[model samples]
Target: MKEKGFRYSILASGSSGNSFYLETGEKKILVDAGLSGKKISQLLAEIDRQPEDLDAIFITHEHSDHIQGVGVLARKYQLDVYANQKTWQVIDQQNLIGKLALEQKHVFECGKLMTLGDLDIESFAVSHDAVAPQFYRFIKDDKSFVMLTDTGYVSDRMSDLLANADGYLIESNHDVDILRAGSYPWATKQRILSDKGHLSNEDGADSMLRTMGQKTKRIYLGHLSKENNIKELAHMTMTNHLLKADIGVGQEVKIYDTSPDNATPLVTI
Candidate 1:
């Protein structure tokens, strides 16, 4: 059965910035705040939410695109900010987000489950070129949602932990061919294609196949590359691959596209 008032939305996604919103009837939280505080607030307003309504902000890593607005929002709203210790170190060393009050800082260990209001949340390590990068799984009642992104490859443990999720916001970052032949510097290209880089469309599809199960239905393709991927190509790549495996794209699972410039409609789970 679906949990009432349980919903998730991608506030913004892509190489430029990323943020996600998740809510239960009693609580609201943000997964990241990469955009400026003003921009994030505007996006929240589009979804009939405000920064002050959020209970916490979770950090995936110290990458600027994943943490630009974190300190600003945390200070302005007095929201708790959670990150693994290593990630916090880099953020502090670089002053990436700015000053965060001691009271607003919360450190979490990967693979541990944390309870906040009506949600049970867990974070797991992912292979990425940042200090302690990770993704999250959120559970409410019997429904589960996985926010899996910013990883070049899915680890065996990640697949095990992510299995049978009801909804997924997974990375479909680039197309291999386009990224290989594009105008990016050779070093940049190599990094993106490396095991610790971002996932290509094909890799993303394969990872989804490995993790999705009977209860999986909703999929949102996120963190697309502005240069190496287009929404249609990423969507079609996953759809065609699923079809080959006898999984009906529209019938068995509904796929949604996220944007770097706007927010996706809040989807109930």
Candidate 2:
């Protein structure tokens, strides 16, 4: 029998690596495969899934933390990989994930909708440092989930595109104060705080306030920097913002934290 609802899990999320798993009863897919194949497989096992069960992998960019295990997983499972042409080009140029079979390489245009099994998937461009970093939205029936991470800032268009999602896996990469005072070099800090860099917790909170609606109840704060942000801080940052907007956390919306080493519990909507 087919599953009755959409379900997903953040297999791993952070600067060290990133990956997400989603299933629509008939199809199982991974959004990124940044960790080693063995590590990804182990994470999958925690969720009662196997790497071989994936039908495809959708790449967001050529960053090593997002595509590290893509080659191995795709080659081992003969799974298709989808990415924008520019991202594909850099991935190939850098040999980031190693060789992928011609058949397994699939180029998708951003801002276009593609259907896969029971879901409708769409990718939209984001303000990130990478050549072609885009975030994704997945719709199954009336339930929609937005995966918006790695972006330095959320544009107005992105905010509009993500409104009223049922769930969001958004980046709350760092705290501005914490990042500004961290041990990193000045240039690195500046890069991280740039328009093409990762979003600060304040930026993320504001973005959520702009995009979240009555239908948006669940949010998974992702891509937190261990050097600059704490899990509790990210959660509190969003929670406090929501409260100020007269939105109830846990009552009206539930916020979850994702980890670099652990898989979040399976979330269904």
Candidate 3:
């Protein structure tokens, strides 16, 4: 019998690497594969999936923390990989990712829509340092799911495009005061706070408040910085924000702090 609903889980999330396992009854895809192929394979195994079972990979950008395992997974499994033209160009130009077969290479422009099995996928531009950074929204059978991370901010334009999702995995990357006081060099710190840098916990909480709707059922905070953001801090930050808005985390929406090292509980829609 086919699975009755859609489901997803964050396999691993952090600056070290990022990957998600997303599946409908008919399809299984990875949003990114930044970790080593071996690690990604093991993570998949934890969820009872094998690397060879993936239908495709949707590359958010060419950052090493997002695409490091692309080559290995694709070559090993003969899976299709999709990214925008600029991302493909840079990955090839910098020799960053592995050599993918021509047949396996696919490109989808920003603002365009594509269908995989029964799901419709859409990508939107985001503020990030890498070339052609984008996040995705997946819809199937009246359900909408999103993975919006690695961006400095989620703009109003994009928020409207993504509002009312059934589930969201958004970034809560750092704490402003913590990031400012940490031991990192000034330049690197500034880069993380720049218009194209990662979002702080405060900004992330605000993003959730703005985009979350009555229909939104869950929020998984992801991509936390190991040095600057504590798991409890991110959790409370978002919880307090929702509380102020009269949106209870457990009552109205489920919120989870995703681990950088382990897989989150499988959330099925």
lDDT score, residue 258, model 1? 94
Clashing pairs in 3: none
Q: What would the per-residue lDDT of candidate 3 be over residues 1-269, giving only the tens digit for each residue?
A: 76665888899999899999888878899999999999998888878888887899999999999988989999999889999999999999998886878999999889999999977999999999998998899888788888899888888988899999999998999999999999999999999999899988899999989998989988999999999999899999999999999997798898888876788867787
Q: Residue 26's C-alpha lDDT in candidate 1?
A: 75
Question: Residue-pair clashes per candidate, as listed?
Answer: 0, 1, 0
Off by over 4 Å in 3: 1-4
Task: Provide TM-scores for the models.
Answer: 0.97, 0.98, 0.98
lDDT of 3: 0.90
Winner of 1 and 3 under lDDT: 1
Q: Is candidate 1 or candidate 2 better by TM-score?
A: 2
Q: Model 3 TM-score?
A: 0.98
Candidate 3, backbone clash total: 0
List lDDT for all candidates, in order: 0.91, 0.92, 0.90
After superposition on all C-alphas, the RMSD of every candidate to the true structure, in Å, is 1.5, 0.9, 1.1
